[model samples]
Target: MEPDAPITIFGPDFPFAYDDWLTHPAGLGTVPDEALGTEVAIIGAGMAGMTAAYELMRMGLKPVVYEADRIGGRLRSEPFVEGEPEIAELGGMRFPISSRSFFHYVDTFGLRYSPFPNPLTEAAGSTVIDIGGQTLYARTLDDLPPIYREISEAWDSALERIAGFSGLQAAIAARDVTELKRRWNALVSQWDDRSFYDFLSTSTEFGSLTFRHRELFGQVGFGTGGWDSDFGNSMLEILRVVLTNCDTDQYLVVGGAEQVPHRLWTHAPQQITHWPAGTSLSSLHHGAPRAGVRSLRRLGPNRIEVTDRWGDTREFPAVIATCQAWLLSTEIDCDEALFSQDLWMALDRTRYMQSSKTFVMVDRPFWTDRDPVTGRDVLSMTLTDRLTRGTYLFDNGPDRPGVICLSYTWMSDSLKVLPHAVERRVELALAALRKIYPDLDIAEHIVGRPITVSWEDDPHFLGAFKGALPGHYRYNTRMYGHFHDQHTLPADEQGIFIAGDDVSFMPAWVEGAVQTGLNAVWGVMTHLGGRSHPDNPGPGDVYDALGPIDIGK
Candidate 1:
C-alpha cells in the first residue's frame, strides 16, 4: 500500500461524507407520515437519477423517474447486433478504484469487474505507441522512446512543483478533509483561471523541454489517452483527475458498465423502509419509467410540476434533474424563474467534450498470437498521433468472440465523423489503423458489423461530459451547492434540485454523479421536513463549517 498521510474524515470535494450517509443504518433521512406517500420527481434514469431513485425508494418516498432515452443513459453498453455475446462500451468504459461512492453500489450488487485493457496493463498484452511516423511496440513504459520518457517525467515534476501533487494525492487518499481543503482550495485559487495548456507552457520544468516534447505530451498523456483536447480546459480539472488517480488502477465491469444502473433499479436491499420486503426501484415504477420529462415549471410556492413527453403532468414537492444542464434550455420547457441569472450563465457556459467510439466484434482474441519473424503480438493496444487517438482490445475468453475499439477519439477528431454512417466511421477508423499495421488484415477476423457513437450528435446528451473551462470553479460550486443555497433562490425554485456529472466538481466521472445524487437526496429529504440521522450528517448538515470551495471568493 502507498504511504498514508495524516488521516482525517472529509468528503471527496467537500467535508460531507456521502459514503457514510449511504451505509448508515438509519438511512438518508425519514420523511413525515404525510410525506411518506408523496412523490419526488427524478429526471434522467442514468447513474445519478437511478442512485437518487434507489435511495429515495428505500427511504419511503416514491421517485417518479423520467428518462429521455434508455435506462443506462450515458452509461450505455452497446451489444453486438449479431448477438455474439460481446459488448461495446460506447460510454463510461473504465472506472477508477478510488471512486468509493460508485463502488458502493458495485459492491452491494455483487457486480464482477476486471482490469481495463489500458496501455501497459497485463490485459492489454502489448502496447504499440505510434508517433511522428515512428511506431514502437512494448509491454511497459521503460521500452518507450527517450523523448516519451522525458515528457512523462516533465509532467510529474511540473505537477509536484506547481500543485504539490504528491501531498494532495495523499490527503485525498486518506480522506483528510482538512488537509485536502487546505491543499485543494489553494491550488484552485491559483489554477482555476489557468488553462491546462498554460500550465504546460509556463511551468519551468515543462518549459525547459522542446516544443516537440510538449506536443508529444499532449499527443500521449500519462494514463488513459491524450490530453490535447483538454489543453484549453482548466488546469484545476486536470489536477482533480491526477489527484484522485482517475486515470490509474482502472477496472471495467465484467458484462457491461450499464449493468450497474440496471441492477440498482431492480435489486431489493434489506435496509429499505415503507416498501414491502421484496420491493425495488423497478417495482415502484411499475417496471417501466415514465416517458421523458418535456417541461419543468414552478407551480406556485413549493409545488414543482413536471410534464412528460406524452402530455401527462404530475406535481412533486421536490424535483431532481440528473440530465445534462443544457437540456434545460434546449429540450425541456423550463421556466426561467427556476434559476438565478448567474446560475443560468453557468449552465450556458458549461462546456462538454465531444467523444466518439467505434467497436468491432472479431472471431476470437486473435491479437494474443505472435508472429514468427518479429515475435510481436498480432494486434496490440495502440496509442498514436494518427487519426485514431486510442484503440482498445477486449478479450472475453480465449475462444469466445473478442471486441476491438478500433478508435476512441475526442474533440476535433470526434466531430469530423459526426455526419458519417457507422459503417463509414468503422472504415475510416480501420484505414487509420492500417497505417500502423499495414501488413495485418483486421477485416478478415471480423464477425459482425461495427458499433459507433458520436455523443455530440445525440440530442438527449449534447456531449460526453462537462470539461470545466478556465475560471469555471465558481460555477461548479454554485451548481453543486444549489441545495444549500435554497434561502437565496426564489421560493418556487427552492424545491427544485440539479444533480449530475455536469453539476459536479469532478465531471466525466460516475463517482461525481453518485455523490451529487446523494446531495440531491439529502436536499429533498430536508425539503420534505425530514432530518438526517445524528450519527451520519448530510452535506448541508455541515455546510457552515465545511462549505463549498468557492474560488471566486
Candidate 2:
C-alpha cells in the first residue's frame, strides 16, 4: 500500500471504532447544541496546540482551545518545597539548541536563557561496584572493562554517522549513493530485531563500557532497567536525534520549556475571541459549496466540542489536536479507523520506560572537577553499576548563590516499584558522589530529596514522548504519510483535521510539535485561500510555502 493512502484495519472488535459510541444517546447527548458553531476548535493546550491557536487567531480565525488537564500538558513546572523560591521541572525539562523553531519562538517572545554548563565536569562521589562479589570504586568510563569499550565505540560511531547529514535535502544531495547507502546500512543494522540483552550477549565488551552504555541508555531512553529493554526500540527516535543534532546546535529553554507556549498565548492577536469554557461540538451538518466551499454547519468548518470537568459542551468550526497520537486515536470519537488501527498496533509494540529525576541542592559553588571538553564544573555522570543511569548538573551560575541543580536520570518500567527504586537510586547516586567528593559531606549539604515525574503513568500523557519500537519506525513513516501531502477537505469532509508532534518529521520533541502545528495551520489557510483575517494573510500569502524556517536568523 502507498504510504499516503488511508489506513484500514479489521479485528474481532475495533476497540476504537467510535460509530457506536457516537450514535449512542449518551455519547450524542454529551455534545450540546450551543457548541455547534465556532471558527476553530483546538484540543490539548500544550506547545503545539497553543502555537496552532496563536497562528489561527493571527489569520483571523477565532479558535477555542479544549484541554483535559492544565494548559501545559507535559511542560509543567513544580515548586520543590512549596513556597520555596526555587522551582524544578517535573516534566519536559531540557530543550536542545538544535530546536531552531523553538528557539525562534523563545526569542520572538523575549524569553531569556542562561548558558547551561557542561554537566560532566564536577566531581561527584563514587560508587563501589561488586564485580564478581569484589567491590571496587569506579569513577569514569575508563573504569569499565575492555568488552564494554567496544560496545560504546559502536554506539558512538552510529551516532556520529547519523550526525553527518544536515537535512533530508542535504542527505539526498550527496552524489555518492554508495557512501550514503553504506552509512544508512550501518545505522539501520543497529535496529536489528533483537532484545538489548541478546545484543549485549553477542558483544565482546561486557565490562564497564557495556555496563555504562546500558545503564545510560536505559536511564535516558527507557528510564529504568536495561535488562529486557530492546536496543532496537525506537529506531526512528534514534534517527531523529542524530538528524537533529547534526542539523544544528541545541539549547535549553530559560526559566523552563513551558515558557515557549506561554509566550505564544501572550502574543496572540486581539481580534480572535477565545471561546469561554463549556463548549462542545456535536454533529457537523454541511451545505453546498459557495465561491470555493462554504461550511453550513453552525460552526464554520472546524467543528470542535469541548467539555470541562463540569461536562458543559461548546462548539467551534475547526479543531486542532496536538496531544499524543495514541491518546487521540483512543479518546476522541472522530474517525477512529482513520487513526486507531496503526496507533493501537504501535502502542502494543511500544513500551514507555519510567524516568526519575532527582535534583540535589548544594550549599555552595563546588567546582571540584572540570570537564575536559567544556571546561566547566557542571558534571554529567553516567553509572555502570546497574543501580541508576547518569546525573547531569545545571550550574545556577554565580548570581543564584550556591545553587547547583543535579538531575539523576533513572529508567524503570514499573511505577508501582518507583518509591523503593528511587530510594535505592538516591543511595547509589550518593555513593557514586562520594568517590569524587570524598572530603565533602554530601548528606549534610544535601538539603532535599529528588522530585520524580512518572511520564509513563501520567493519565493525560501515557508516555514521556512518542518513540518507535523496532519495526514501528517504518510503520510510523507510513502512517505520517497520510497527513503530510493531503489537500484541504471539501464541504463534505470539512471541520475534521489532525495536528501534533506525532505528525511531524521529528518524533517527540518540541520542534516536532511546533513544526506539525505550523504545517496544519498552513494547510488549512492554503485551502481556504484569501486572507485568513484582515491583518494576517493566509499561509500562501504569509510565506511562500509551508516549510521549516531558518532559525539561525
Candidate 3:
C-alpha cells in the first residue's frame, strides 16, 4: 500500500505531516556503516533532545545527551514527596488530542491519560466563572448568560467570516497541504502584523455585541481563562491555537507526562543499527548524561566541539542544541559566525511569555461536595479576573488526596507573584478564591506544603514559552527554516543544528518540539551521508514548497 500524506495539524504556514512522519514504519533515514559508530552531541535532555536521540539511536548513531538539571526539561512532574501519590505538573500538563507527534511517544511508552479539567470539558465536573466580583456556575456554555452565549456565537461567526474557519479546518483534516498553505499564507499576510485584540475588536459579529460582552469573552474564554493577555500578541498565534483545537479535548498524563522522556532514555525498540537489540540510551551512556553544555564552537569543516560546565569537551561530526535559543548567547559561549546575522537577530529577539503556577495538595476531592443553595459543586475549575487567573482541580481518586492548581497566572499576573514565597502565593490565591467560595474552608483540606513555579525565573528556560509578538512571523520563519540553511551555510555551520519548541513555528506545544526534533534528526542524518526513503520524505525534503510564510519580504 502507498504511504499516506502528512497530516496538516499545524496548517500550511508550518507544513509538516507530524502523524505520518512519526508513524512511518520505514524509519526516518538510514545512516551508512561508516557513520554508524559515530557520536552526535545533543544538548539538553528535554522532549526535543530526547526525541532526536531516540530516533537517531534507532538509526544506529550514538547520541551523547547533556542535561543541566533533570532529564525531562519542561515536561516536569513534581511529586509531592518520595512516596506521595500526587504530583504537580510544574511545566506542561494538558495536551490536545491533535498533537500526534507528542502522543506517538506517549502511546509508545504505554502511558495512560485522562481528560483534563478545562472549563466546560466533561472532565471538568463544574465550572465557576468569577469576574468583577460576580460569580456564576455552569456545566456548559449554555448555562451561562445570554451575553456569554452571544459572545461565543460572535467568535464562531468571526472565525468563519474572517478566516474561513470551516474551509481551513476541513483542509487540515484532509491533510491538503496545497489548500492549507494557500489559505494560511493568505492569513499570514493579512494577520501577521495584527494583534488578537484587533481581530476581536473589529469583527462585525463581535462589534454587534456589547463591550462588556467582549470583555467577558476575554476574561472567560471558551476553554481557558480570559484571553485579554493574549490580545496584544499576533493574531496568527491565536489562529494556530483555534485552528488546531488546542484549547479543548485535552488530556493529562496519568502518572506524569515526564515519563515520556524518561522512558525514551532506556527504551530499546526494534530495528536499531549499530548496537545490540537491548541497547538503550541509558545503557549506552552508563545511566548518566553529561553535564550541561557550556560552550559550542565550530572547530573544523563538518565538525563541532562542545564544552560542558566542568571544562569537559568532546567533538562530534554534528551537534544538535535543544536548549532554549537565548541560552546560546546567555548561557553558552557559541561561535558568533556559526549562525548568520539575520538568524542571530531572530534568536535574540525571541520573546517568551511569563507563566506562574501554584499547586497545593488537598486531603481529598472535597470540591465534589454539593452546595446547599446552588446545588452545584462547592468548588469548581475556576476562571476569574482576580490574581488567580485560572484555577484547576486534579483528583487522584475518591480514596487518595487530590491536587489543586490554586493559581495559574500568565504575563503581567505571573510577574506579580515573582517575588512571593510559595506559601504566600498559595495564600494570596486562596484569599482571592475565598471571595467566590466564602463558606468553603479551602485551607482546611490542605494536605502538605504547596508547590510553585516561576518559569521566567529559571535561567535555563528563561520563560514559560514563546509568545509571538506582532511581526514575529519573519523571525519564526527564519528559525523554523534553519534546518534547510545547512545546504547554503558555510561548511563550518553545517553540522550544528537547532531543535526545540522555541525553534519551531508552534512554540509552547510539545508537538512543535517533537516535530522539530524529527526535522533536526533528518538534518543530522543527511549531514552524515544518510538519506530518507524517497517514499517517506522528511520535512526538509519538501521544505521549499511547504516552508513558512515569508511575511518579512
How many clashes does each candidate structure show, in the order listed?
Answer: 0, 51, 2
**Where does candidate 3 clash, by residue pair?**
218-226, 219-226
Model 1 pairs in collision: none
Models ranked on TM-score: 3, 1, 2
TM-score of each: 0.97, 0.64, 0.97
lDDT of 3 by residue, 202-268 (tens): 9999887788987998888787657887888999999988888877678999988889999999898
The candidate that achieves the highest lDDT relative to the unseen native structure: 3
TM-score, model 3 to reference: 0.97
TM-score of 1: 0.97
Off by over 4 Å in 3: 1-10
Which run of 10 residues does model 1 get worst, by summed lDDT?
Answer: 4-13
Candidate lDDT values, in order: 0.86, 0.46, 0.88
Report the lDDT tens digits of candidate 2 across residue range 402-483: 3333333424433433565545645665675555445545566555555556566565667666545664544444334333
On a 0 to 100 scale, what is the lDDT of residue 500 in model 3? 95
